[model samples]
Target: MRDDSTRNTIIFVVCSLALLLLYQVFILEPAAQRRQAEAARKPAAASNTTAGPVAGTLPGVAAPAQVRVVTRQEAAAASPRVTIDTPALQGSISLKGARFDDLFLKQYRETVDPNSPPVELLRPEGARHAWFAEFGWTGANVPGLPNANTLWTVTQGSTLTPTAPLSLQYVSPAGLTFTRQIAIDARFMFTVTDTVANTGAAPVSLAPYASVQRQGAPAHVGHSQIVHEGAIGWLGDELRLIKYSKWAKDGGMELPSRGGWTGITDMYWLAALIPSQSENVRGAFRVTKAGETNIFEANYVGALRQIPVGKQVTETTRFFAGAKTVPVLKGYEKQFDVPNLNWAVDWGRLRLLTQPIFSFLEFIYRHVGNFGLAILGLTVVVRLLFFPLANKQYESMTKMKKLQPQMEELRARFKEDPAKQQQEIMALYQREKVNPIAGCLPLLLQIPVFFALYKVLSVTIEMRHAPFMGWIKDLSARDPTTIWNLFGLIPWNPASTPLIGQILDTTLHLGVLPLAYGFTMWLTTAMSPPVGDPMQQRIFKLMPLLFMFIMAPFAVGLLIYWTWSNVLTILQQYVIMRRLKVDNPVDQFIARFTGKSRAA
Candidate 1:
């Protein structure tokens, strides 16, 4: 007879290695390629791509736009601009097409360093990796309608501020008078009121439309799976998400929605258009090509209106382009009557639990003033809530441990009769009033909460660049300190060594938090009832170590939460084991330590 334990252990190790290889091949490799690609590209570089306005194929939507890639300086020099200055924003609006093409976030930085450059949100078209929002009228066979090249002169204010708005005016050769009034709040919302009059001899037909366009996708941010970076919208009581990969694979999406918003979102930033609440509009997430680059656009075309001679049409559209802060999104959702604006955070299918978890975490952070401490507080509250289930789980584990010897004896007596051995063991369990599967109830129940907490920490902007004590500078990121470099004590960069440096960094990132989590996990696993099958027991014993490596690259905030939860579980289980007179790892360790001390 072969030893199944040895075979299983070998199989487990191979499977673990296979998983790591797959992770490297997929997640790690793609992230490296994106980072490398970003580093290689220069914003000032020019391209030979020809571009113009996008004309929608739909009946009412026309005068489509084109794509151009040019230097940032050329973009600025292309047309005169109205400056935008606010508490949280600094950028310019191009007088050409009256587009918001250049913007930066004032309060946020590209890195944790205070002196790092501010985050760039919207950049001009023809600039490398361009992202901007454009609003105008699209008309069928209406030559006088404004296009991207039509230059507008400022009619109201030169500088757009929270207190002062900017109004631009453009007159077509056919005697059409168009005016756009743009206002920005202190934070991220942009309100635009567009009015056009038909001074032409005859009536002209046109439709109002707004679009947020990105010339290309940016580098991946956060864990790509958990953090949404693509098209998202809440239309007709449903939140729709189309990820970038999926968007690229599946060409375009068009939905006829009323009073809804659609936008392209990064992990922490968003550029969205909220159409007027009064009218029905067709919202779309579409992609176009520009010299090998994919241009993504989220746009809406409202109902077409006919303007009689000397008559005018006015419409209001709101655009949000800035940080995806929860409070800010929620405020806009209520104030502007936008439906499910907060859903931009990618709360996932477990939103029922994730949303409240994030809210409570925010509340705790507000009171304690530290997010790391706030997570610890959350773990304690969760443990208290699940105390009863945990107690029952521990009680069941203790009973199972006590029945181990009798179970083995039954197996030996009925070795030749496998069915009889199982029947006898079940009878023994019934007599002892032990529910065999009860030991896993508490852990199974906590899985959803664990996932919810991970999602909150991973996706929320408030947690980005958040710090804990010691070496943890960013809770949203993985721990920076690595065991390979002796936690930076040694003057060496493991990631600069050679071709193998990155592989080493990814595979062996044993930081203090990860190590602590592994130790606590092992302790809790040790307290659990030993498995009856030798093969199962050996595989179970290896699980903690294998999972430690798997989780080592995750956000330290998540590791802190799990480690604290494990510690609390251990304490509770130890107490239950002692009260029930069951032998446990804690008491055994203490006794052995005391005995060795006496002997010494």
Candidate 2:
């Protein structure tokens, strides 16, 4: 009886533990995930004003005494108007009614009027100097919603000032709510707190959306741009261009419609205009599962809400808006998605190896105060760090070239038996203590590094509009310096045939750096082993030209790094060849390096 009781107690304890684990993994986790998703979808609702007649009653014989008293009482009960003092910033504006125009733009001007309608009340004042603004919809009644009416009232409530360290409460039509405020530290960064609540009797279902429409261009034609920390995507009328990112598709999906456009980052910023009612409105949507959340931007136009009668649900979210400036974006570390915007470095496994290169370039920028020089410094540092490895590979290749005669003799000796030929070659390699794979390691390691650096230079905003020495104006743009023209009509022409001229212009004339890059590539290949097969030689010879063609349209800063790296490698190889005497007779070279007398 005692043993049975002990066994039952142990079994009960084990069962309870198992049940707890199951609850946490399956039930509690999913519920927590749903709550987080709701947190991210804090929809911005529309504001409302009290209905009233215009002031000054018309010429009436007598006004009701009771009506007059009620009117005065209603006026006294209205919320007092709040005023925002303008800061010292030159482009500063004011906040008053709900104004949507106060939202920031990457490269455009904006304004706001305080005396506009209720919708205009959402318009923010003092936005010109602010990094971002909460505009578009505020209050209870959202525009374009069917069968739903809203009333909004503001009261004399204290708000956390810019200098205040603690959160403050402001009474909206719903109830008192806590709001967090973030200061704009730079030109491109702004953050705001989101306070949403289900101020009704039951649970409220809310779907949040954000949209931006530039005034000057149509949606598709305009450059719809987004930069998260390090990744950037842009949509032109014809193509969607994207930089490097962890995701397979760097450039976003192409749009079918030529007139309207929607852009979104998977878990970050999203924008889309409300679609017309006649169109099949598949509105913008987002979902979160576990800890992963996905945000979508679509051509949907409508509000989503299900507010119960009494229960209150609320949420807070932060927004960072502005240009894709690294320093500015880094300041708002929590708000921006791609801090440092390093996603442009797309080399799959080599991203880690090449990160130091960017760090070195940034360091150089700190001292020299110019981005172009920083690129040059980065090139020098990379070349020096890889010098030993590159030299070792080149030396091995040189030895392979010298062994060619011996290898050919072995091949001839066993020409009829391919298996025997390979065995003999392996034997010869072992006897000579030569490693064929040694020549491949350096090149293999460099491929990914090269690709990653290519991406880094292409999208870094610090290089945008930054000037290098001489005629080069922007490191992030194609090089503009040119010497002479082969054809009078061709722009920035180099001395070559029309076809060759186009190629050269595409590669070399984009900047002086690419020309330097091509020259170094040519030199490096000159010292490399000559391919024995005709087809292989032809292919090898075309590599430099292919690279030049590919790099012509790339940003000049990348070209600078590539060009300098190639030049340094060439110099290193030249010095190694001279010092080791590999350029001379093979027998003598072996005697010196191996300390062995040649077999006579």
lDDT of 2 by residue, 1-600 (tens): 221233244335434544553454345544655554564364221011122111111111111121121232232233233222112111222222111223323232221223322111111211110111222222244222111011223332232223422222333443323233333333433233334444433343443322322111111211112222212222222223232122123212423321222322211222223122222222222211111111111222224445454443333223333333444444533334322232322223445754566666777899999888887887676666676887777776666556768877876788898778778877776786666656555655665666567555644545556778776767766656543352244464453457676545543454456566766787677666554445555655766665554555557877877787777777676666666555533444478989986642
Candidate 1 global lDDT: 0.81
lDDT of each: 0.81, 0.41
Question: Cα RMSD (Å) per model?
Answer: 4.1, 20.1
Prediction-by-prediction clash tally: 10, 38
Question: Which 10 consecutive positions of candidate 2 have the poorest summed lDDT?
Answer: 215-224
Q: Can you tell me which runs of candidate 2 are displaced by over 4 Å?
A: 1-97, 100-186, 189-318, 334-357, 384-388, 408-428, 481-511, 584-600
- Writing each residue's lDDT as its tens digit, candidate 1 over 273-318 gives 9998778998888887655566788888899899999999999999
Model 2: what TM-score? 0.51
> For every model shown, what is its TM-score relative to the native structure?
0.90, 0.51
Which whole-number lDDT from 0 to 100 does residue 284 have in model 1? 86
Candidate with maximal lDDT: 1
